[model samples]
Target: MNQKHLLACHERILPYIHRTPVLTSRWINERAGTEVFFKCENFQRGGAYKARGATNAVLQLTDTQKKNGVVTHSSGNFAQALSIAAKNVGAKAFIVMPLTAPKVKKDAVKAYGGNIIECEPTLKAREAMAEKIVREKEATFIHPSNDEQVIMGQGTACMELLEERPGLSAILIPVGGGGLAAGTSLAAYFFGTHCEVWGAEPFSVDDAYRSFKSGKIESNASTETIADGLRTQLGDRSFPIMKKYMKGIIRVEEAEIVETMRFVWERMKIIIEPSSAVALAAVFREKDKFRNKHIGVIISGGNVDLNNLPF
Candidate 1:
């Protein structure tokens, strides 16, 4: 997407999404030996930054499309986001969620007026269900992280971050489907003054890292990670943007993800999911490289299952 598209998306979704706050912690800065800013999307609508993309996608639909409604498959955050966005626009949202998704997320989707369809906990099952809904209901399918509108909408978070904290040396974001990473990298390229963008992924699901090295989109061999929101693979729309704009990808272990989550909660006094912690863990993974530099970390979401915390 171009700068104009990104700017238009930020304006289009402004009324639907929250302009989440940016936070900083002296303890975290000292530990990382850098001035780190946290773009807290955890406090956003639906408790995630996905609201930005979902809202943008829904608002752009034609009248006929809105009447037919929208369909998507997501494990959690995007499901809640699309539900809330659709409800705000008086459109129906059919969400195909895996049976293994967190109950809290499922409840949030229902509360937001989405029709939930549970399926086997597999990508194939989720996509098949979504496709079936599209055929039966004549609904428009919005891929959670693959659509052009969604990617532009996701970039607005980084755009806001740069507006608040200019001159940042780099930005670190968690990579799951690569939408947010691609968007963040584009925002850094267009808005920041020479700011580099990096991605963080769990070693258990390090497809983004492998893909970066191989110069092609790659799939994860294992989905065994505490960062449940990050278990998906990258898409065609997002991969090319990431390949061109992202500086690198850092892979952190499961233990590192858990420790970073707890550290943020204990020190920053904010609830961040494991997916969000992946970014901070990357900074810690190579402190020497980022020493004394101004860095921005996008806190992707805070939809944690209190009963099943990794800590």
Candidate 2:
């Protein structure tokens, strides 16, 4: 979970992953009142920044680990990430995903040689099934966000972005399990212009926001949001890091996320999912805060079925 490790991983992943571009939008800058630049991770391999962490984690696996294989649970993104990463290294990946996971993501996992196990929506249900499958199949457990290696790998995204734009005044990232936020904040501090990093989450699943204010895990009542990629809770490793480095969490409404997604599509010509749009939602909602400043945003996963967009 150190900078050296993250740097080393970037070299390893250079050949395997896409060098997703840092795109600028004049329309976004005018609308958000900030000179905005977006790190288009939605165009990344496996369709999300999760692929960076998943690839680094699997590539560093020991010979014994490769033979034993790995197991993990994801609503979608991380499962497909692990599946493709495991495939590149010739390891078996047992993916326990909810039936509610998007069909595109689930199909990607299958196409990548993943063994899918259906589970209920609850974390308890997913964990129970993943444990059973791991025990039966003798697969190593590759946690979605909690692992230190995964956190370090996730940090590399911010490294790449900050390296490309060192004068960034502030940065925005969508907060799901807080892995990306925590990792990106650390890397921003390392490479950027003393920039403040902010975590953006949909109000539908505003656990990180409440958790930051209340100083404890505050579970949302019921998350009915279009941002399916952002519904997961913060992990033990991620929460402490986010609490230390991140400025604070911004909770955007579901409508804001949808509108931002559509806006980014029409303006930037990028196909991003709702989770990716939360950063834009933050800027759109609080434009004055970002006025006349150099701002950066990480556009996350892009694994959406275009025909099925609720917007």
Candidate 3:
């Protein structure tokens, strides 16, 4: 995707989405051994960075396309985002979610007026179901990742971070499908911000990390992390962008992820879900490396199920 295209999308989306805050914690800074600035995407519309991309994709659609409605397959947050975006654009949203996705996400999609379709938690299965729905209902498909407009929209989070902290040393984002990582990294690269962007992933499902290391695509065993949003295999389109612009991909253990979640909850008094905590875990797991740097980390989402504790 062109940087100009994404830059324009940011301008179009600013009036629609929240300019979520960058919260700094003195204690987190001490623990990470860095000046830690947290871009709390947990505070975003639909409770994630997904909103920016989803809104942009919907906004790009014409009135004729809006009348046809929109369809997408997501683990959770993306569905809620597309549903809310679709609602804003006066279009119907048909969202296909895995049976294993969290209830909080499913409920949020419904609240935003999306029609939910249940599917197995595999991307192949989700795509199949989404296509079937699209064919039957004559709805326009809005991919959760891999679409240029969507990726540009996802880049807005990075734009916001750079705009807020122009001198950031690096940015750490939780990687799932790679849209956020790829898009955000490009934004940093284009702005000449001298910021190294990194992707954080759960070791349990680290296809993106393996892809980065092997210089090719790699799919791990079936989904295994409590962070449902990080299940996807990185896109062919996204892999090149990530490899070119992202500094690196880091994988953290499931235990580390849970520990980070607990720490953020207890200290930040913020309800960040497991996926958002991965970036924080990345820094804590490698405290020696971040000794005196200024790091920006995006907490990708906060729609957690209070009843389910991964620890």
Candidate 4:
């Protein structure tokens, strides 16, 4: 998509989503040796930035499409987002979720009015189930991260960030299926004065990093990352945008992810998910690069299972 698309998306989804605040921590700045601003999407509607994309995609649907409803396969944030977005517009949402997904997430989806269809905890199964629902229900499919409208909607988070902190030198976002990373990159390119965009990925599931270096889409052989929200692979739509706009991807270890998550909780007193911590861990991993510079970090979500916290 282009700048105009992103701007329109921000306006279209404004009423449906929250303009989450940008927060900062003096201690965090000292620890990283950089001035850091955090765009807390953890505080966003549905407890994640996925709300922006979901709301945008749902709102753009025609009456017939809305009547037919929307269907998507998501294990977490996007499931809740799509359900809530559909409910707000008086539409039905059929969500295909893995049986292995956290109970809390599934509950959230149900609470938001989604009709959950359980599938095997595999991408193939999830996709098959979603496709079947689309055929039988004649529903529209709204991809969590790969759709152009979703990408533009996700960019609005960074657009808001830039509007509040125009002088940011750079922004770091966690890359999963590459929605937020791609969106943030576009936002920085269009809105920032000279802001650079970077991505943080788990070494356990470093498909985005591998894809960036190899100049093609890459798949993960294993999804063994604690940053559950970041286990997905990049799609055709988001990959090209991120490849063209992102500066680079920094991979962090599982331990680093947990440590950063705990650090943010204890120090910033904010409950951020491991996926969100990935971006901050990247900053700590390469502290020298961002030293004395103004950096904006996107906290992607806060839908963590408290009972299973690593720290």
Candidate 5:
């Protein structure tokens, strides 16, 4: 997408979403040897930056489409985001969640007025259920991170971040389906004076990392990471943009992810989920490369289950 498209989306969704805070920690900076700015999207509506995309996607629909409603599959943040966005736009939302999804996320989705449909915990199962809802109820399907509108919407977060910190040398965003990463790259290209976009992924679910190296989409054989929000593979729509604009992907160990998660909660005094912390973990993994630079870390979400924290 172009800057004009992103600007239009920013304007359209401004009244609906939050301009989440840009935060920093002296301790973190000292440790990482860089001026790290955390885009605290955890404070965003529906408690994640996914709200930005979800709202934008729903708001971009036609009246007839809105009347028909929307459908999507997400185990956590996106489910709540779509539900809330649909509610704001006076449309119905059909959420297909894997049965293995955390109870806290499932409850949040229901609380946000999403019509929950539980299915087997597989990508195929989730997509099939969403399609079934679309066929039976005539709801429009909104892929969490693959739609063009959704990518433009997701880019708004990076746009805001760059607007607030134009001199940033680089940006680190957690990669799952590559929507946020691809969107951030567009924002950096259009808005930043001299900024690069990078993605942070769990080593256990390093499909994006593998994809970047292999020059094609890649899949993880197993989802065995604590960064549950990042288990999904990159999408074809976002993959091309990512390959073109993203500098690289940094893969961090599971221990590093958990440690960074705890560090943010304790030091920053914010409850960042494992997915968000993955960016910080990745940053710390290559401190020498980032030394003295201004880095923006997009804290993607804070939708963790307190009852089962990895720390």
Candidate 6:
């Protein structure tokens, strides 16, 4: 909510999460006609920035609450993040994963010591099962992107980015549930000088973009995007923050997402998932607008299953 709140979150989670590096590529700079700094959250703990929020949430739990543990329904990164964070904080994690979720993600959650609760591949079903577990075990439920503490914690990544590069003209991030976008916008508002914040999302799942324009939450008619991590819609807590601070939302095609993922993997020699590529693809979709500007992109995560490459 404020710089102090974000800084406190950073201080709390600093020892638990990674201060991921910011990297640049001359080729990418020329291609976009902008000096871009990519905050590589892909190299973060649990392979994503989700670790920040999950760890912060876990660490904030009361002693009794920690005894009861925490529960969440996530298809991928957040599941792994909560599992690892809870394990690190000496608490149990109950992860309700959809049956259709990729095997690699499920395996990662298990590796982190999460109790996997398989549910039907629907948001309603996932939430229902998570609630069931919470009721039976008296555990706390943590929404992946909706909790205030989670939002404040997620802002740390952008806080670090802006601290490392104070000259950035703008910051861009992929918007799935709007947590990262909202948090980044807050960081830019509190840290950067004259910096703008933008949200990038896939056209197939442009609910966040439409919600931004309509001033209300919107649900996607289809969930066919290859950005598996972005299939979820924005939450109420993150939506209002995004509306208040975000400059605009940019929608990119599925092909553009795939191409951007390939570009980062082949050109930058770094692995990035489709959801992470959405921000870069949106920048490429509107290169002239950012020409000669110093921009920052949040590479949200890099937990791809190599056997299922989109290319």
What local distance difference test score does each model get? 0.94, 0.86, 0.88, 0.93, 0.93, 0.93
List, residue by residue over 208-261, the lDDT tens digit for candidate 6. 989988999999988899998889999989999999888999999999999999
TM-scores for all candidates? Answer: 0.99, 0.97, 0.97, 0.99, 0.99, 0.99
- Which has the higher lDDT value, candidate number 1 or candidate number 6? 1
Q: Which stretches of candidate 5 lie over 4 Å from their true place?
A: none
Q: Which candidate, 3 or 4, would have the higher lDDT against the true structure?
A: 4
Give the best candidate by lDDT: 1
Clash list (residue pairs), candidate 4? none
lDDT of 2 by residue, 1-311 (tens): 56676788789877788888999988988888889988988888888999888888898889888998999999988998899899998899999999888888888889888899998887889999999988888888988887777777788888888889889989999988877888898788777777999999987799999999988766767768788877788888889888888888888988888888899888878799989999889988988888999989998878898769967
Lowest lDDT block of 10, candidate 1: 213-222
Query: Between 3 and 4, whose TM-score is larger?
Result: 4
Each candidate: RMSD? 0.6, 1.1, 1.2, 0.7, 0.7, 0.7
| Candidate 4, 9-92: lDDT as tens digits | 898999888899999999899999999999999999899999998998999899999999999999899999999999998999
Question: Could you tell me the lDDT of residue 253 within candidate 1?
Answer: 93
The residue ranges of model 4 lying beyond 4 angstroms of the native Cα positions read: none
Cα displacement (Å) at residue 47, model 6: 0.4
Residue-wise lDDT of candidate 1 within 1-311, one digit each (tens)? Answer: 78888999998899888899999999999999999999999999999999998999999899999999999999999999999999998999999999999999999999999999999999999999999999999999999999888998999999999999999999999999988988898999999999999999999999998998899989987799999989999999999999999899999999999999999999999999999999999999989989999999999999999999888
Over the full model, what C-alpha lDDT does candidate 5 score relative to the true structure?
A: 0.93
Candidate scoring better on lDDT of 1 and 2: 1
User: Cα deviation in Å at residue 26, candidate 6?
Assistant: 0.6
